[model samples]
Target: MTPGIPGFRHARLPGADGVQLSTAIGGSGSPVVLLHGFPQTHLMWRHVAARLATEHTVICPDLRGYGASDKPAATSPDVYAKRAMAADVVSLVAALGHDRFALVGHDRGALVAFRAGLDHPETVTHLGVLDVVPTLDMWNVLHGVSAAVGYHLFLMAQPPGLPETMIANSADVFFGSFLDAWACDPAAIPDGVRAAYLRASAAAVPSIVADYRASAGIDVAHDQADFDAGSQFAMPVTVVQQDWGAQLGYDAAQVWRAWAPDLDHRLTRAGHFMAEEAPDEIAEAIRELLAR
Candidate 1:
C-alpha cells in the first residue's frame, strides 16, 4: 500500500458486464472518482485522492484489466474499448452509492474519463483530465515527432499475437521505459511505487495491450460517431498537459476546446505522469474544476 493517503480503505466492486474493479474509498461530502492511467493503479492517486478526500468523498478505482481489477479474456478489442471501461467506472461509482459525481483521470484513465463524460453527461458532473487529449484528437494530431513519442500506441495497435508476445517477453523494458522516460522528476515516483507499477503492468501485458488496441479500432469509431453527431461535453472540464502541442506542432488547447465548450486548459512542464510529479498542482486543478 502507499505510505500515507489518510482515511482511505480499499475494496473490490462489481463493474459493468461482470468485470470486477478494485477501488479505494474515503472521506465524505460531494463525491469525486479518480482513475489511474497505464502502468499504474489506484495508488497513483495517493496524494491527489488524499487531499480531495478531506472535503469530498474520493473514490479511486483500478480500471478493469489493470491493477487488481479483473482482466477478462480478450475475445476482441471491443471488450477493452474505452466505452466498456467507461461503463465500468459509471457502474462502480453507482454501486458505491453515488448516482452522480465529479470525475478525474490521468493518462489512460483520462481517456476513459473522456468517454464517461461523453457517454454519461448527466452522471458525470465535472471532468478533469491530466496529460492527455481525447482519443480521436490524439490520433488526428499525430504526425512525425508526436507519433514517435507515442510509439507504444502503434506498437500495441498491431495485430493481436505479436504485440502481446513481444511485450510479454520484455515486460520490464516495455513498462520501465515509460517509468524512466515519462517523468519530469524520476524521483517523484518512489522506488516502491515504481516497482508496484512495473509488476502490475508486467502481469497484465496482454490485457493492457488489448486496452490500447481497442483505442485504435473500436474506440476511434465511437469517438467518430460522437464527433459526427456534434456531441459536446455539457459539464465543466479541466485539462492539464505538457506543452505537447508546441513539441508536436498542434494546438492542444484548441483540440480539447472543440469537445468541451466550457474548458480550463493549462500547459505544464510536468511530464506525462503529472499526477505523481506534481500532485499538489493536479489536486488544485481538480478542486478548481469542481468549484466551477
Candidate 2:
C-alpha cells in the first residue's frame, strides 16, 4: 500500500459537482485544508501536514481528477476549472464539519485555493499560496523567459487529443521532467514519491490535460471577470514562489498585490516543490497565517 502522512487516516469523500475526492484527515483544533499542485497528489503535503497536525486539524485532499480522486468525463472545457475544483475543496471541508477554515495550496492547488478565497470569502479565513500567481496574472506576465520556462502550459493548452496522446506515449519522461527539473534538492522527492506521481499521472493523462486546458481558456475568463469586477481576496494571504517574476522580468509581488490587498509575498530559495524541499518554512508560513 502507498505510505501516507504518518498519523492521518484516508477517506474517499463525496465532493462538489459529483467528484469524489481522495482525502487524508488528521489532527484536532482549528481546521486547515491543504491542496496539492500539478503532477502530484495529496502525498505532496506529507511532510508539511505531519508537522501541522500537532496543532491543527489538517485535511489534505487530492484535487478532483488527480491521484485517487475520481476523474469524471469532461462535459465541457470549464468542467476542470479551478472554480469547480475550489468548490470540491470547500465541500470536503464542510462535510468534515468545519464551517470555515484556513487553506493552503501549492501550484495548481494554489489556483483553487485562490478561487475559494475569492468565491467564498467568508469561508476561507486565511489563504496561503506556494509557487504561483493568479491564473490571469500568470498568463498576462508570460513572455520571453516566462513563456519559455512555462512551455508546458501552452503545450497542454492545445486542442485536447494531441497533448493527451503525446504525453501518454512518453508518460514517464514527461512527468519525470517536472519532478527532476523543478526541484533544487532532488533528495526532497525520493524515488518512492516520484514513482507514485508518475504512476498516477500516466494513468490520468486526459483529465490532467483538461485541467491545464481549463487554465488557458475558462479559468482565465473567470479570473478576468473577477478582475474586472474589482473583487479581491479579503482574507490574509501569503505567497511563496521561486523568483520567477524577477527572472522573467515582471514584479511578482506587484502582480499578486492586485488580487490580495493583505498580502505577504516572499521569494524562496527552495525550488518549485517547496513543501518537500523546505517543509519547515511552509509549515511555519501556514502557522503564521493561521495565527494572523
Question: Which lDDT values do the candidates have, in the order given?
Answer: 0.90, 0.91
Q: Candidate 1's error at 177, in angstroms? A: 0.6
Off by over 4 Å in 1: 1-4
Q: On residues 52-166, what C-alpha lDDT tens digit does candidate 1 reach at each position? A: 8889999999998998899998897679999999999999988988899999999999999999999999999999998888899889988876579889999999997999999
In the range 97-116, model 2's lDDT, one tens digit per residue, is: 89899999999999999999
The deviation in Å at residue 116 for candidate 2 is 0.6
TM-scores for every predicted model: 0.97, 0.98
Candidate 2: where is the Cα deviation over 4 Å? none
